[model samples]
Target chain A: MKKNLSEDFSMEDSLEQIIQEKNLVYRPTRLMTGATLSYCPGCGHGTIHRLIMEVVEEMGIQAETIGVSPVGCAVLAYDFMDVDFTEAAHGRAPAVATGIKRLWPDKYVFTYQGDGDLAAIGTAETIHACNRGEQICIFFVNNGIYGMTGGQMAPTTLEGMVSSTTPYGRNVEQMGPPLKITELVAQLAGTYYVSRQSIHKAATVRKAKKAIRKAFEVQKEKKGMAFVEFVSNCNSGWKMTPNEANQWMEDHMFPFYPLGDIKVDGKLVKNVIQDL
Target chain B: MAKVRGAIVVDIERCKGCEVCVVNCPTDVIAMSKDVNSKGYHYAYMEHPDDCTGCTNCAIVCPDGAITVYRIKN
Candidate 1:
């Protein structure tokens, strides 16, 4: 007589299955299951989203994580990020996140905001939040132009950059120089860590993930404030395919912004790529 | 001994096919499949199963929890 061995077999199998899936869902796939993403083909939004989830899982804080969404393509962050999320006013993700953190100081708060939100309308809020030394992390995604708002020029748009607003290329005399957020934030004494990284290339993406992970660690330790600005590609706005955006960033933007850390722990940590 | 074929399968029905795993695979063993899955998004696939060294790079960077790797032991 055989005692149905199904129970014993399934128990081990299900556990192993969870282990197998762990590689994919490091923090237990928080992304809402739906049809394919609405993003255009080859956009950097997907890459940055993945990086955030991977970083969240690695830190084992998915349960304690809360995200503040912005009004750009990042507005959909609440859908992709499986954790609790709240949308912020046009460019006030930092301020919105500050409120959430104040209410629940033990939680990890992150704002997934775009260049428009981080560098323009939300600039004052972002700057003041940093000044206040809020124990939160900001994931500032700078793709140069505004993706969700129809390829308009953003404050982070490089000088002479062409966009819906600047069809003839942005002239420094008229538009002023591009906003370098990492450099600007590095000046703030409240910022405990500030790194400017990219997702255009393979090696650079790896570094960006590490920087994000470190930011999460800072949040876990309740470090004053941490900011990692990702120089991501806006393929939809740039009118180039995703691969082209990556190539463009590697060729053009790398020279202007370069790659590496601007500040950490009151001292400057160098970007290794810049040395080479 | 068998050639120890280890194929990387991405559960597209289960996959958001975000392309994170495709770019993160250290060995470059996986690439987006031309044929879209049931979800209508191109899922990652191992083209050269022979070249896969059982490293599971595809599994590691997958943000959607969709990849499954089989290591066939003789």
Candidate 2:
């Protein structure tokens, strides 16, 4: 009986029909290459990469944008993103981005750096670039520990946060307090837009995307440095499940690195620190 | 008014089975599969296809960019 059936009854035809009828609401942006991300499962790095690429695609600036990724887990970021990318030395992404932006003048330049690369060894370059009002966007991912190096205590590691080096958790007096690099950079006169965001949840993801778009827009206007900090989670480093890490980030990390704009339109938006 | 229906395609290879989408799905439409992918992770799939609104919440929160959402009006 089945032999008499029409060829249109084939499985492929039905799938084609279904696909033709449905509207594609969301698909992975083409700006991201087919390379599987090196980031661990549930890491925010992939999401941030997607958001930045999506913004560049939506703005029709894919050809005009250049990215600099320095040492750390994201050192191989260029392999995943399709846009033009340059690999900088450890903690030198900001300087590389500055050079690129200065050379091109019209090109949109940005840097992707991790907490260890940005807040620790690269602190001098980060501050100097921002202080000089380099026309570039800085995407800082602060997971609080050296994720790539087996979870060493980073400069931004929260006080009392356990790490491989700090087996007893971070000691504030000895290690000093966790550096609020986002807030510190915001105090620089050159930064035009400085904001901190997280991408753990759907709502926060949307807000983070908006912040990234704003940063790019600020760059397009030839404004001073636009710094965006993403307070992310390092599940592997933290020894927690992906979901548990996000929840822990909410409960602990958010209190110290609150998500919001510290500066806007070349002016300080709010005093993030009461004492300082 | 026609009823709106939504569906999703999970790229099995790309999904890392992190369960971020499972927790973010508003309709409870997604769940980790008992079967494992090539990477040995329990990837996410639509367990309740009829309930999905194509809100894109799961896709938005997906760290691996493995899920693509589609919607149709009946």
> How far does residue A181 in candidate 1 sit from its true spot (Å)?
1.5
In candidate 2, stretches whose alpha carbon ends up further than 4 angstroms from where it belongs are A1-18, B1-4
TM-score of candidate 2 against the unseen true structure? 0.93
DockQ (C-alpha based) per candidate is: 0.20, 0.48
List residue ranges in candidate 1 displaced over 4 A: A1-35, A270-276, B1-6, B13-44, B54-74
C-alpha lDDT of all candidate models, in order: 0.73, 0.90
Q: Write the per-residue lDDT of candidate 2 for residues A1-276, one digit (tens) a residue.
A: 545444435543433433443478899899999799898999999999999999999999999999999799999999988899999999999999988988999999999999999999999999999999999999999999999999999999988899999999999999899999888888889999999999999999999999999999999998889999999999999999999999999999999898998999988888856613
| List of clashing residue pairs for candidate 1 | A30-A82
Candidate 2 DockQ, CA atoms: 0.48
TM-score of chain B of each: 0.74, 0.90
Q: What is the TM-score of each candidate against the true structure?
A: 0.80, 0.93
User: Please, what are the lDDT tens digits per residue for candidate 1 over residues A2-90?
Assistant: 66554445433533433344333223244443334556655666667777877787678788989999998878778776788999899
Q: Residues B1-74, candidate 2, lDDT per residue (tens digit)?
A: 22326778899999999998988998898999999998898999888765878889999888889988887645
Error of 2 at B54 (Å): 0.4
Model 1 chain A — which ten-residue stretch has the worst lDDT? Answer: A21-30
